[model samples]
Target: MTTNPQETTPNDWDTRSPDVQADQVAAYDAMRSKCPVAHDDYMGYSLLKNADIKYALEHPEIFSNKVSTRHIAVPNGMDAPEHTAFRAVNDKYFTPDRMQVFEPQIRQVVKSLVSKLPRNEVFDAMDGFAQLYAVRIQNVFMGWPASLEQPLIEWVEKNRRATLAGDREQMGKIALEFDGYIRALLDERRGADAAADITAELIQDVIDLPQDLGGPRTMTDEELISLIRNWTVGELSTVSACAGIILAFLAEHPQEQDRLRTSLAVGKTAEIAAAVEEVMRLQDPLVTNRRVTTQPVEIGGRSIPAGAKVTINWASANRDEDAFEDATTYNPHRSQENNLVYGQGLHVCPGAPLARLELRVLMEELLATTDLIEFGGANPTQNAVYPAAGYSKVLTRIS
Candidate 1:
């Protein structure tokens, strides 16, 4: 379904103003019903409807992922055969059984961070717990040195801050620095002839597949470096942001918090898990994913030219009125089988299992240990307009 450019209004871009943020759910409802495939520079070609997003993710060939560095990873960029190989490499490390091995370690990381809190006093969960814990956990997964964790965290912070500064050129420079760091790690892993971690495994084991893009069948140095940088950014940013948001939600809704506490009391980890999904659905940290048209296609009764960029606002689709009941409200008990937070179809987040593990462990720790996590100071400012959906300063009071 294509939309007429003349009829497509700029009013559709929900750019997260205070008013917009407050009514994002309402805005998405309107967009999905009235303008499912409207064009706007801010949101690209908006795919607000759940069906539309589902369609887009399913047909990766038409809606190609190979955008510029503003988006990274050859897999993230590639459409089909290329995308498959890269994703296969990632799945090698991110398998469900492999992630399950780290459950105890993830719990320890979460507990260790929470344990450091000053008893019954105020602190920023974003910094003291969420960001710090996310960084450490990421290191654990990647088999990176613990010593390098702070520097990597500081680098991502700088990259995010540069984006918030509205400096695209500066953001690129920061990205180069990040890529350089990944390259150095890749080099070390390749040179060292020893038992290696996942990162090392990627470098040593080449994907023996068709290479339409370049020379070798395997991932190039640049591609490997790119994947590492992208994985780190995606993992660190989303987990940190979601952690703070969940804490904020729990802090605001003591009734929900108590429900979680009592439910966990009954040894019902299932209930608590359901609550996490609800929180993820309501939070919906990611705004949208961009896709480029590889061929002419019609959507919403209008024709989009080949090579145009499209944006599927998952944040909006997760709140689609047609798909969700009272979409705005935080309903933890809301059925998890339908939510669009982790996206749908082929492009559904492969890191989802690890993300669930991390979220579960953190929530369990909060429920088992703390009396309450309260917002004491001003709300944390969102870090960026795209990708990294999180707080700038999230001050809090936890007891």
Candidate 2:
């Protein structure tokens, strides 16, 4: 139940269960406050304190992202100079200008989905509202055929299974299937050679790596397919989870909902943004991010040797008592500039702005239309392993 700073290691992480991971993070917070930095060969010498986390994030040299736990783009994998290059490929798509262009489309997507809900009927908001909306938008962003939506849902499920199983053959088979699908899309875009969609823009993007690390790095066809697959894996499940969690919290706290409604009356994005942040804090979509040490390093005066794997307890770090007041309680207005939900440093999420926009807009639309959303059936249970936190079903009545 308690994490001893001197006891845990990088190798101790459970890659399969979010509940178990959450427990580990909770335990780590106990030690983080006292030790700040600690050694655990199982955990790699992790710097758990807020100060240490900031340091580790900012100083990518000491703690690298080159060998990522997720086998995709180097965005979350590669550290420093190289990280910047991988990030740039999709950076423009998530920029303010692009977000402005995508806003109407995103709003329309949410609106259409919400309109389809039966009047006064109970439905699972997580499945009906969150996952459906997020998946549709993701498809829009990826330029995938609409027909593939069902396939995508299946793909995400199968991909998660492969990842947890560590089945490379199964993973590769799925990846090839996706690649063929994307390649056709790529070919279509190339054939038209006209106005570019976000996916097309990414395909044509030439990543310019820093000279110090290497020359310009272009995303190969396979890499592009992998990146899109990774994006599908990384973005959809968490966003959907967050969407449901936000609504669930709002449904439970009518006063907060009233406050949010009042703010929306005046068209204040900050109010909704604040509420979303709190949801993010409480929901903690991603339980952990893992890394394998390439070189031995000393942390908290203890040395962690090379080739060790470490888990970044994001959920724990965000809730560290040292970092926030009443870390366990949900406070909508707690607007700190740094929240680990999107991550930190050079490897911060490239799609964060778009994701934020998606969340903010989804909330706004929901609040505007629905007066009340109350759970109708059994309490929703989340997936224990893959996708970390999300409802298997969340039946609710729209008022």
For model 2, the run of ten residues with the poorest summed lDDT: 6-15
Q: lDDT winner among the candidates? A: 1
lDDT of 1 by residue, 109-178 (tens): 8898878876666667776577788899998888888888888888878887786557889988888888
After superposition, candidate 1 runs with Cα above 4 Å error: 1-34, 69-72, 192-195, 211-217, 377-387
Off by over 4 Å in 2: 1-49, 68-72, 192-195, 210-214, 300-302, 381-383
Tens-place lDDT per residue, model 2, 100-212, is 98889889988998788877876667655676677899988766668877776777667767876779899889877777877887777776564467677776788897677
- With a 3 Å backbone cut-off (N, CA, C), the pairs that clash in candidate 1 are 1-298, 1-299, 1-300, 2-299, 2-300, 2-301, 2-302, 66-77
Model 1 C-alpha lDDT versus the unseen true structure: 0.75
lDDT of each: 0.75, 0.69
How far residue 267's Cα lies from its native spot in candidate 1, in Å, is: 2.2
TM-score of every candidate: 0.88, 0.85
Candidate no. 2 TM-score = 0.85
